[model samples]
Target chain A: MSRPRVIARLDIKGPNLIKGVHLEGVRVVGDPNEYALQYYEEGADELLYIDAVASLYGRNNLTEVVHHTTKNIFIPLTVGGGIRSVKDVELLLKSGADKVAINTAAVQNESIISEVSRAFGNQCTVIQIDAKKKNDKTWEVYVDGGREKTGIDVLEWAQTACELGAGEILLTSIDQEGTRRGMDIELIDAVAKMVNIPVIASGGVGKIKHIKEAFINASADAVAVADLLHFKRAKLSEIHPYLISEGIQTRKVLGK
Target chain B: MTLNAKTISILDYGIGNLLSVQRALDAVGASWTMVKTPEEVKLSDKLILPGVGAFMHCANTLEAAGLNEAIIEHANSGKALLGICVGMQLLFDYGLEQGRCDGLGLISGYIDKIPDQQDDGSARKIPHIGWSELFLDEECPLFHNFSHIPAAYFVHSYMVIPEHSNHVIARCNYEGADITCGVQKENIFGLQFHPEKSAQAGLEILSNFDSRI
Candidate 1:
């Protein structure tokens, strides 16, 4: 059986990593690279670097961060935010990014997904979907840094992204994002059921139990926790065993 | 045919990070250099193809740089050659990515989209990224210092399925098909994962490649 992957997400706005109450009142969490190496040493399987200001700034800071991070760490890094074209993907990869995530650009120009995929290969392109539950019945998709509402159902966007050669789906819940209430398991389960590719469950993780819940109920191949890890509330050394006890397959703990 | 005293040439296609790959060679203390010219590739004992991009673009860029024929010549000279990710796909005969395009044809195979396994309405996702275990088929030099089920980082959607299964050196099960993660022949090797970014297992794989040459 394949082992479940544990990923730590770091949301960067300028030089600081912000922690908030549901993506609102953000507090700086110190240098992004400093936090990255912390999780890396804690045995976090992968690191996600999302430039929160990319859409607002009209550019991605991945090239600068990735170049800086890859110099100190050896783990794979996936970057997202404001990736508008294949050239953007090219620059990120050249700068040592293992994978590039596309959200707004892929939704606006679906062909860009295939175009970038064809130019770089599908493995390098990741489609990040930020969904907010509008009500009990429908969820709206947000693009351009969650500033614009597409009104399109998040499910439809996810299916289309996979068809366009998006290798992985970074499914995030805007309503649950940064809440630490728990992962929006419903959204994760829904997306995981639809996409055959590896689905990474993101948003609404408050504790180690939330990670376990995300994996077990959502059946996600991996889960990304931002607040819990960023705040040093949960360490991977303890998380893996907890996951194993909960019937999740994990890579053999290296030291033990 | 012996590469007893030769330098390994790493092809710098200007698409992917070559420094980490170069550093891996340096970590094992292997005599290697990044070769941008055809002359460098021809004289090397081994060739390392490292790249990140669409198959056609890489093929085109390589041809444009006058390294395509040089690659063929290197292989024809019986020099060991290895390709990573898109670099690995370039060793095949053809690729179906971004329309039809020709490859180096060093090995017999083609690159195709990862077939969708969801019958219920999921689109087949491209760019499979993450770490996966290698189910080694035969004991090759690449596994010398690595554990049996060493984890390596991967980031690709399309993969090489050679006509002959004998050429498959390692595999990782994704969806249902045993995706061809690694391929090898007498003097050629290709991996769909980035060994440079794959951590210790990755470094070990590079170390084994160095020892083999």
Candidate 2:
């Protein structure tokens, strides 16, 4: 078994990462650059910078954020939000981002995904899908920072994105976001079983066991956690050993 | 006659972020030129091949740009040639990344995907991102300042399985197999990981190359 990759997600609002109860009221957090380095030093596999307010602002500051993060941290960093065109993708890459994630833009224009993939290769392009459980049997895909309901099927979107050359899928469950009730494992399993590309399970990780479940149950390549790591409830050292015990491969945590 | 500074020509095949590779070279006072032409390759004292993206795309672009002949010519002259990441994989005979893509064939090996060593059979994560320690075979001049270092950035899944084991300079533990981290064969050098982004360890490796080349 290969080591499970750990990616820390930095949810940005304006210039800083913000944490809120659910997705309603938000409060200012610390400098994103500082948090990013902290994760990098902690030996995070990769860093994800998602502008949570990009759709609200109608613009993303990923270029500036990526430049700052890369200058200090040498790990692979991915930037997402408001990435609409190939030029937008190129700008993020030029700004020192290893990969650019597209969500709403990808759903709006499917061709953009193929074009970016063709131009930069699949590795540099990732498709993000925000999903919400709509009924007992179905989940609806959300767009525009998980604000608008696309009403598209999750399975269909995941397959389409992969076919269009999305290297990986960053799947975030709206119903599970900030709930800390653990990930929507069923949804993840459904998507993971469908897509050939690696699926990174985001939104709803509260404990160490939850991370293990993500690997064993959901079949996620990497788990993206926000509040758990940010709140210091789950340290890398603790998680590393726990996952290894459960027969999951993870990078050995160096002495802290 | 006093010798002037040697120009390290980096092969540009429309694949990599040359600026990052160039920046690393510049930091160590290595005079380099981003060469896209065959003439520039023949003119260089040292050569670097930096690549990103698919193997076929890069190989085709290099052939179209006449870099293949230039590289062979340069290597035949016994000038130092270093390949980074996919560029490193390109030094082999062929790559199994997507299809049976032909490589430069300077080394007798083929690039293949990292198999999932896990019993569950779900460990085929494409990009093996992040930093991992490199275990060296023998202390060589290429690692003068970076001996037995346990920290270096790695971001590839496909690796070269050399026909000759002596060509392997370094290996990193991943999944089941000892993944190839660095490869060296006389004047030809290849690294599966990015030395530029490997921080101090990377800098030291480049420094060693600077002094040796």
Candidate 3:
């Protein structure tokens, strides 16, 4: 098995990176490229970019962003939001993204998952799921960046996505997002168990303990940090060391 | 633009990440071009075949565009040909992907799924999507004088099984399974791991390739 990955998530709104709570009340953070480069230099394993309003606007403007970032950063780049078809995936891949995550469009048309898998191999196809806790045992799937409720069970959708050939799942908790607290360990645990593909736990990572819990308790293969990284609550460089201190096996780049 | 000195020609079959490859080449201070036409592929000296999807899609596109012949000719001419990931898989004789897909057959072997069970009968991920430490064969010229790293980035479900054991140059131990990740036969080289995304060490590998062959 590969080591657990630490990824930096940047939510893009037009040309700027933004921060949102519960996937709402958005505010600009800074230049996404700058933060991405910083995270890469700080020993981050991967970087992800999700267009904040691409699904609502039915357009993704991340090509230039990805193009500019990959110039120096030589890690895997996974882009999400408004990716509805194979053409969209090709555009992102051509723009230097190693993988792509689909959510809103996948909910509307489930076949896109398999389609992308066949067109670009399962390794590059990622299914992004936005979830909100429905109760203690279940979570509802939300779309359009957590704005629309699909009434779909989170566990079931994850399994379906996996069966449909999605290589990885980017599971974001709507309730815990941008909370500056801990992640929804129960939610992540449930979905991570439901899918065989790698699950990237996103939302509500404020400190090192939250990250450790997500990895150890939730069995998350990777954790995508946003608020914790963007708010300067912790340095991207320090998180991995803390994880290592706890005997967690995370990826380490050479001479970093 | 003049083809003054044989530049690094990357065969773009509309299925691979040519940009990142080009960027890696540029970073290594090697002049490269995204060769999309069969004519251009035939005219190239140092050719790179890149694929990043289902074997059937990539194989079909390569054959349909008549680029496969150009690639074979380039390889047969004793020119150095590098294949990346799915491109490397295509160098084999057959692929057990959806059905039995014909490959370029530059090397004898089959591409099969990594299997649900490892050597110890333990379960592992199907896609095998992450970085794994590389165990390279020192005699192989591909890694000569190259900087060793912690690991190279890997993301694939299938493993290449070359018919000739001598062709295997590097292997990674995954779940007690010593899977082949790099292979070489004279001027033809194949790497299952994506060096373009493996950080600086990866860039150095590309640089080494540029100067070596």
| Residue range B31-105, candidate 1, lDDT tens digits | 787777887777677889976767788888898998889899888877789899889999999999779999999
Alpha carbon lDDT at A180, candidate 3: 72
Q: Put the candidates in DockQ order, highest first.
A: 3, 1, 2
- Evaluated against the true structure, the overall lDDT of model 2 is 0.79
Task: Point to the candidate with the largest TM-score.
Answer: 3
A144 Cα displacement, candidate 3 (Å): 1.5
Off-target runs (Cα >4 Å) in candidate 2 are: A21-24, A56-58, A232-238, A245-247, B1-13, B22-46, B94-102, B110-136, B139-163, B170-181, B197-213
Candidate 3 per-residue lDDT over residues A199-253, each given as its tens digit: 9999999887899999999989899999888888898778877897898877655
* Model 3 ranges off by over 4 Å: B1-6, B119-122
**On residues A143-224, what C-alpha lDDT tens digit does candidate 1 reach at each position?**
8766688988988888888788877889888888888889888888888888777888888888899988988887788898
Q: Rate the local accuracy (lDDT) of all candidates.
A: 0.79, 0.79, 0.87
Model 1 scores a TM of 0.88
The candidate maximizing lDDT is: 3
